[model samples]
Target: MATDTTTFKHVSYLWDEAKAAELAGDEVALLIYRSNLLGADLRLTNYGGGNTSCKATAKDPLTGEDTEVMWVKGSGGDLGTLKRSGLAALYVDKLRSLKNVYRGLEHEDEMVELFNHCIYDLNSKAPSIDTPLHGFLPFKHIDHLHPDAAIAIAAAKDGKKITEELFGGTIGWVPWQKPGFELGLMLKQCLDENPGIRGIMLGSHGLFTWGDTAYESYLNTLEVIEKCAEYIEQNLGKKGPVFGGEKIQSLPKEERLSKAASLAPVLRGFCSSNVKMIGHFTDDDRVLQYINSNDLERLAPLGTSCPDHFLRTKISPLVLNLGTDENLDDVAAVKEKIAPLFADYRKMYEEYYSTCKHPNSPAIRDANPVIIIYPGVGMFAFAKDKQTARVAAEFYTNAINVMRGAEAISEYTSLPRQEAFNIEYWLLEEAKLQRMPKPKPLSGRIALITGSGGGIGKAIAKKFAAEGACVIINDINQERIEATTEEFQEAFGKDSTAAVTLNVTDAPSIEAALANTALAFGGVDIIVNNAGISISKSITEHSIEEWDRLYDILVKGQFMVSKEAVKIMRKQDIGGDIINIVSKNSIVAGPNNAGYGSAKAAQAHLSRLLSAELGGDKIRVNTVNPDAVISDSNIWAGGWAEGRAKAYGITVAELPAYYAKRTLMNEIILPDDIANACFVFVSGLLNKSTGNILNVDGGVAQAFVR
Candidate 1:
């Protein structure tokens, strides 16, 4: 459906000659520009999947003589966001000289270590394994991209024949080979056999294009991809409904999304058995069409053809065979059936690993599937972080497009199981995994802090996000939400936090907010009931309306929020934490504070009640009681400071000193102090404790728990 009506579809020519001229003389700059343009379109390549390079003559720092250097994207760098610093510069002559040491296929991996010796700049980033692929090519500029359209032709059963027919030998074909020195040599051999070919289609892999200039290579790559997409589109137009027509009708939009949200937590739980995982859900038309089609059963089990796709989505996806006839709303029933489905999938994966693993293969990683396809609903992807989960889903979508194009022209052919295993368990890949930095304490956890627009709520949100938790900052004030969201985005990445408007006292509002949170970052793992209101008046001065407002926000608000969050936590089947931001007044009685004190008392008791009731489910409910947090507190800003100052027979400015002098430690309390106490409960330090109250009032003895 995305095909171009006339000249192009699936991709576009986005080159800007005006921009290109700005960096005309700098080869690395031009390479970055070209790579960015190609990466801008997912149809061209998935994130961090492809590599680009250019050969340029530069001054050798050591010899002070002009030498040809190859600048290529460094290991683990993404093209779209690449900077000059992300490139690895290696001496072209030194790379070429390695041919004498190359001992053939068996010693290919050893060459990776040798690449370090060819480094033209000592400060350059580590070279990618694909360095040899670019080094062995004779062209000044080259691009190896995994475009779905190009890969479709490469993944077909008769791919080699199709390549000859599509480009009439202008584009050559090479049989399937794992990337290394051996594959690089195979490419050189192919070029030797066909001298005039514009590019080479690496079987069951991707396409490689080259040109004497950066602009030329950029154009040639786009042109070849466009041609392949057009040919596939024409063939698809003549074919029947994709994947042998839809076998099941998709659910209505609202129902479908609700079902996805309901199931995401359960799936996340299943996937996190080995380690916690964040989740992503998508119901894009392509995914829906594939999952609802007749061929899903056959094609999904065959697994992804491309290595990039295989790496992200694992060897195969687990397809859930739920039908429209089932009760979509009965999440509990669906939950019961899904466990065995996941069990069966893990069993199959173990069998696959056992069948194909070599003696040197790395120990099996988690057997849980990274991707799960639910018929009539959509696809779900889980990973150790939010971005990876989302990107995994995107990569799988690319796989779906490849399948559609390959099936339209020729029967889709997946990589052989043994080959897929080799890549999945490659020692180089294991080393890459081992090199990753240790995950943060709160990595993969999602936290929702109510009233996070300012004050104590904001502090908790910042702390959680800094600890690597994806935070949902909830408040009724849209303006404050936007401001705080922007601030967090600048500090942590945009994906690290989401903002939502919520009124915890209102049931529908609470439901909508939680649903949105689930949609934003899968589901809730922690809830900080920090939303509150205060009316510091005596029993006689406090009107019924004022009393109700205080109770509504302080007592009922917390109960409603915790009630909704627990549902998600229970479904997740993972233990969770709920921290209530109660006040010291909850225990120590004081004058002219009837409404505020009673509401705090109710909230504190509610926390204890929930802790007792929810202990069976491994959901901890704890309380943080603070006496006075005058700084950055909206409660103090809104006349409560004056009321408290009057009660203590002091000025508003003296309120801080008054509250601090009364404490045993004689220390003033701050919002961050309260946040720290909350952290102590949810930070896994107190994972086994529940129904506990951590007072953060600078040691207020009167407010201490008995």
Candidate 2:
């Protein structure tokens, strides 16, 4: 039969002929292709919430023996961007052996240990809880996805019969089973029953397909899910509009705004924005009619579409009735009523735990619904933020559709309560929860300081080291290299930071410095392009040699360092932060320093461009423009003191006050003041703020009274 094209457009699929041809090929490329295919399948399923895996050969650590191992995707990874390390390698033989054990094993703790055992490299990321299932799959490529259309159809009454007819005999149907060992066993049975079946569709769960190659398995999954989607759309018709609660005309204006704000925060927390609050009321006339209808209880399940969704949206929405006053003051009363219902839900959950769990099963998780739907007020999906709330909503909506359809097909049957408990409380899943390394704010993270060993650069390095960032100190001063290294070691502690005596003007030296810094710190996370030499020559007097020298370090150096940093950051997948230290001269344009100002201006603009390009990766790039801060150490060495003294027709001693008085704040800008700006940019406090230049000249650049 020709496949309907409606769902096919929405579904991502590989042509059957192409997949079949690719599968009839060499194994290694096929393995990689399968991995990508599984990634693509997951991305299509639930819009990238799930992952997939496969078994491959790698050298065993203990025996140094070549062993077959199951490499599964790591936790907290998006399937679309999964890499080699994203997959954790587990001993395939060991996993298979564990599955065949006769004696009852301590499933949770031992399974957790087994998951940990797979993490042979401490530096490597942790594997997911579903790793065991991937290991159990006899096929080299396994695909798992929570397709919305298939689940919607499977959730209705007579779901089994409908699925049977839709997929025909080639597809095996397993009643909704909680994921993990029990589901694994059930699937294994289904596999045994239909040896030639292309895939398995779980009622009220999801779809699973496998193949000798990744392409076949992935294509099989797409074809099957597409068919199910087509059947649902053709038969079930479009889902009706979601009902919003009754309008609250009687609510106090202030209270209503507050209620909106409260809801806004919840949504913003999930979605990362405090925008609109879209609420659906269960108390709406249509909803109330549906609820009061004899079929209400029949439609309402205790919780969400799937157990894992509970982590996002709560078990069930709160059903509100219009009989009660819709006042913010009465919100407490609403919650009070919800308390008992939740209590009842918990009681049911405990009973399920008692029936389903083994005597040795681990503790049960707290039963709190991620979403609460009010009858008249509307629905609230609770989560850490709006993004999470939206994700929960999508998951629950898909689940509700599936459950509704499954109820239509057959009595809505989910995985047994005990099986759900096992999957929910599975040790393997828990083992995936590893603590993320705390951000250094500065330390160990690679930093490239442009004018290192000089005044501001030295001070910035010292401050960064004090805050914990490893320093890559660059300087044009070959004479001061040894002394600067000593000073850095003294301030940052031995081995805490390093010094590189390289002219930032030289591209080769800049590249080499970056390589050394990466080798020293494992990766580059921060770049401080602070090195710049100022010349007090007017445009007419500015020599080509002087202009080249100034631009080479001030502008070209910043470009080279930023370019190299981005390359490293992209590879590491840890977004980097770049701080370009420009000068107030770049902003205010001091006479006779046109070349210096022009270069710094270019550098400043470069920061903005980089910020735009790298923001998607979470890399922040910003510039710091500081007014003159005079120090005897800086002035005496670079001829700045004499030159400025000549310009002002004053002694070197008067130069400090002359510069300090220029600021409206009348406060002397110190190198530390500039370093302070660097600190804030690198810290996550300004995580969302990037591109713009931060004027650290004591409000001098504001063009206003201080």
Candidate 3:
């Protein structure tokens, strides 16, 4: 029978009898189905925070005898995305036998390597640290989750007392212990001592529930969380004004976001001192409620209670209390104070490491805080990439929920300082970090390419994204922006790129685009001034309006975009690249192209000027000159092809062959060829050289830089 959805109030009941029935009898499949359901709701477990397992009888290959085997989630796998291949299958007897060789708590880490010997299936995924916790339980089905409500109770000052009162001896309690063989033994001992307990609350950790079948375990996990959520909700309603009432009024929506945009670049720069970092900003109601509250100062440094939470958010966030109450109007003034505070934070982090370091501690990592809180604004999370930064922000948000619940019932408690450090710099964790795939050259870089709807701009965006840079696809048409954004989102991840509609000649539009880029991925590190329009006509035939339009797009557009982008790059204090896609007409001086050719010449000179001016700030500006790029070009589609063909005494369709023949190398230029030239400048190959022009005109001697 299907579980009645109406019984559950705090959490969603997504289990469908018909759907689950399809996966029945296949125990591993049922385990995956149950895990997916639990993980589907963040209320149950945040991303990659929990694990589930089932013990089933499988055929032993060597003896062809049926043996009990444990299939548990592998290290680093998310429960929601769990698959058969994601589970590490091990022989139950082999895992149980390791208890004989266990050398006590001091040498627990060695158990990790021993786990490999217990594999029931060849080529199985690596088992998680919590593998023994499930393997020794002796339950047919088990669930371990980090549900916020349960964690709130777990992290509460009176967590044990509350558990005894709430469940009345049905749920047992275990003191805070870092995950390892020791904790697993502690869990087993608790189950043995409390013979009738339905579950266990892992103090300062999470919850553990079990049952004789998959359905029972899933139902028990949900019921426990739902009951806890109900209790938290009741207590919260009784308590007036969470976090001792809001200390600072939240800025209005538009004003709040505008402030976030203004401050993000500066903060991003400070955080990237060690390595390039991406930033994520959230003004979610929960974040504002906490940061704007009086207790923010106290709780911000206390840090997160859950291991998963601190692993992502770091031990503590750096809270900035800019002098003014709520008015952050003087952004420059506020920015000035941020640097010294950040320096203090770095010093404090280093001190913590030095004090906590053991003989075998891993070297200190980036001393900068992963999370930064501005009371009236919101929270900003920084990491090595967009998705990681976003996830860290989410983990901090979960910590906020836990804190709210714990405070409503009892005082909220963070993990002890030594414990937090132990987990943060664990040798096993250091090994995992070392095992990660090497980062791509442009891994942490963010690029904004204008006129990327199609043509050279689109090609450049693709190449940069492929090389691991997050891209912002900008175009004048909304449809093109949507299409390109969707395509990039599919190819890369949703976090890998964003889209903006822009008209570069308009200053306000340019500012809005830059702001959007800041909100999307901290700030822009590479600017490709590719937005352009071509008008091919004789000087006498060209209307003044045509000439102005050409200049507005090709020349002034590049100037405006560069002008705005440089401001952000300067605030970031990180060197950046600006690549302008000019045309060979700038120097070759082709006929019937007066307006286009003059604008191209102006654009080329602008690159040189900016290269000279911004060199002090380490900003490199370069230009790429491509001639007769007729294939997949918006310029050719808009009557430029016809005009150019007329000037060259050929039909529109003959332009490609005719233009190619005119080049010294007889090579026809494609949009990708121009994109390659842009990469050459931004790929760090020409780091020292600037104020130069590279001609991509199939070796056109006349267009060569003199």
Candidate 4:
């Protein structure tokens, strides 16, 4: 199960001997210990996919007597790293007694209601769907999982025969049945008939193992699954390609990253209608091997090895191969090709539902594909944000491995289209979406913060991410960007931030960074032009190179970044926000500050010009003039602070107060003050306001916008 080929890898068997010894006989502790062991394995059960349970004893508050209780994994709890609180305790007598009161439970929902109401402790959580299956089994410990290898055998047409041969009668087989009270009864009947059997394979579903102790049950699962894995390797190793498809080698890493970076945003725009999604790209060797295979198209559409995956991956991927190596640069052409494919994909999904849907199935959900595979380039997965997109992408990556394993063992077979439809439209998955908290104002959007390695740029990046925008940390400093991006990811969550090295003065460098920004989080929807430098010198004293270098970065550099963003924003048709970081020097001239002041002043007016030009295209352009915002700012790092302090005839420590006292409000402006002004523009609080200068220099009268 820990093989390189297996997506579900068990890193190590770790257990706390002290804790185990402390509660050696306590069923709750044993269940917690064994559940953690199983849940920690991604290959054993994906995040919260499977459940575990055990029978325990608890004191009845009213009766003052030790009562039998069943501890099961609570609803919405993941098995990996599950805590004792994550398990719910139910009175075993009360749970088993329900069987007599309500025989032949027909509906899945009602069974859930019964389980929820039967909790022995008022403080305990609700029970999982499989609570009864564990409660009914007379064993002390029970474990169940949707292991990919086990499911590959269990979901097969001749799964029972295969299970019989693989386990040699050590495990029992139960036919497919909806998981409810009936399945619980069926399993009870199965174990009753075969008293010596160590486990049971639920055909077309998963595996269940039991023992008198937690260790016995856990070991049974590992041993049984390992046998099944060996069987597949021996049998499927020599098999020919079951699904015939043309072999296509993917572009190398460099080519694929470039190509994928360009197309991901376009695909995001294509898939999105109401809310834009972020895109994540991957060309892992395994993923590339699968995508580059001759049987990708023929194999990918067969459905998931297990129905549970359908909830996340859908019935089939939205293949965007173009089936060629041609460039997909034209926005209109890319849309034209995708529109028809999506239309046909939706139609086929609808037809699949119509032809295969069960009568009790839920309504058809969104038809957009969760995973998009583009041949010759790589794969793109889209979601409301980067974390969700990457989750689905990783799942698909692991799934591709699982599918390939199946294909090699035999023809890659999958659950029927109908089963996929059933699981996807199930209420549990729907509830996950419905129960989600309301998104922040800028959720699902992306903002690129230029020069975010330190100072005001970093502050702006932080504020934007705090407001729910996935931030792209662009800087010339590789080390700083890496550290800052990690901090953002830890504070915000995976896919919350990205990092790219950018030299604004270099056209090729800027283009590559912008493409990378698109690859990381769809496209940059908010561009913060914050990177700049200051050189205090008189116009006459400023050498030609010094003047040109200052202007090239402050004025020309911003234009390059803005121009690239405008193109992407225009193509997405999703209106964008741009805030150019200028200085109060732009409003009022400063002595011997000609090089810095003139560059900022020119860029400030350029903002006004772009505002007029891009307004019709739904791109807002604005500028902020700050007199002093030196908190962690690198702009003053080039000996400019000491020179400016000398000009004021004061120490560098007193310069902040000097600038603050000069302003009308006498308020010391911090990096956060500048960031706030930018957020106002980005959040669209003033939609009718653009081409305006907002000063963050503590109310500077001389720098007033009027």
Pairs with backbone N, CA or C atoms under 3 Å apart (clashes), candidate 1: 4-9
- CA lDDT of 541 in candidate 1? 79
lDDT of 4 by residue, 569-606 (tens): 86677778889999989878778788888899899999
Residue 640: error of model 1 in Å? 0.8
C-alpha RMSD in Å of predicted model 3 compared with the true structure: 1.8
**Candidate 1: lDDT of 190?**
93
Give the alpha carbon lDDT tens digit for every residue of 194-238 in model 2. 888877777666777777766656666767777776665555424
> Which model is ahead, 2 or 4, in terms of lDDT?
4
| Model 1 per-residue lDDT tens digits across residues 36-97 | 98889899999988999999899988779999999999999788888889999999889878
TM-score of each: 0.97, 0.51, 0.97, 0.90
Task: State each candidate's clash count.
Answer: 1, 53, 0, 5
The alpha-carbon RMSD values of the candidates against the true structure, listed in the order shown, are 2.2, 16.0, 1.8, 3.6
Q: After superposing candidate 2, which stretches have Cα over 4 Å from the reference? A: 1-7, 14-43, 56-67, 100-102, 105-109, 115-125, 153-157, 237-301, 318-369, 372-380, 385-387, 407-706
TM-score of 3: 0.97
How much does candidate 1 score in TM-score? Answer: 0.97
1-706 per-residue lDDT for model 3 (tens digits) = 1356588888877777898899888999999999999889988898898999999999999999999999999989899889888999999999989999999999999999999999998877899999999998999999999999999999999999999999888999999999989999999999999997889999989999999899899888888888899899999936678988988888788877888888888889999999989999999999999999988988888999999999999989999866325344454676687889999999999999999999999989999999999877889999999989998999999999999999999999999889999999999999999999989878889999899878889999999998889999989999888888899899998989988889988999999999989988899899999988888888899999999999999888999999999988988888899999988888987889889898899998999999999999899998888888888888876788889888988898888898899899999999999988888898877899888788888888888777
C-alpha lDDT score of every prediction, in listed order: 0.89, 0.61, 0.90, 0.78
